[model samples]
Target: MTRSAPVPAPAVREMDIDGEVTLFHEPTQTALVLNETAGDVWRLVDGERTADDIVRLLASSYGAGPDDVRGGVEAALAQLAAHHVVDLPSPG
Candidate 1:
């Protein structure tokens, strides 16, 4: 089964300070601070690219193999989903 691409929540507002990203979830009144790598991941969650695409892109940008950064990228996506900053689509 293939999962749909993740989408940033409509109520989530993002701010980039220097390179780090701060996300504010309006409905939950919650905030999440993302590190550089996580910020990159957040920016790419445009309801288009799948998680695997994100992993491959980041790995290539960092000069590492996809296997090397897959875990961290997946973890970041999970964390964003937990915070309601991004809505992860269910497997179909």
Candidate 2:
């Protein structure tokens, strides 16, 4: 079965400045600043690409091996989830 892709939370507002991204969740009054790498990951979280697909796209963009970037990509996704900026699939 295909897993659903992660998506940004609807209430989250995103701002991009100088290649960095800032996310604000008004309901929670929480804000998160994402660096260049994390910002890239955030831009790709369109509810269409799986986390693995994201890692592959990033790796290809940087001409790096998928294994080399997977961990960091996963970490970024985890951070987004923790901040309620994105929703990830629950582990089965």
Candidate 3:
């Protein structure tokens, strides 16, 4: 099955930890601790933006490609999701 786009920023929130790192979550608790690159992607996880938007932002911000950023984001997000750190919204 195809993965759905990430929920927009308003529906979620993020916390940046030490270094270029951050955590995404709701008001309850932190969902994940993003490493530098992953943190970059996490910072862009606004409820208003899609995963595609994050890929483009990271690519342009870090001089990378959409595929590269997308891969990293997906991997990190998967790990986070697996750990129950972040919440993927139900498709609208």
C-alpha local distance difference test of each model: 0.91, 0.90, 0.62
Worst 10 residues of 3 by lDDT: 2-11
Q: Give the per-residue lDDT digits (tens) of candidate 1, residues 8-66.
A: 99999998767679999999898899988889899889998999999999999999999
Ranking by lDDT: 1, 2, 3
Alpha-carbon runs more than 4 Å astray in model 3: 1-32, 89-92
User: When superposed on Cα atoms, how far off is each prediction in RMSD?
Assistant: 1.8, 1.7, 4.6
- Best of the candidates, lDDT: 1
**Local lDDT at 89 for model 2:** 75
Off by over 4 Å in 2: 1-3
lDDT of 1: 0.91
Which lDDT tens digits does candidate 3 get at residues 7-57? 433434555555545545565555555577756655565556666777788
Please, what are the lDDT tens digits per residue for candidate 2 over residues 1-92? 54478899999999876666899998899889998789999999999999899999999999999999999999999999999999997565
Q: TM-scores of all models? A: 0.92, 0.91, 0.62
TM-score of 3: 0.62
TM-score of model 2 vs. true structure: 0.91
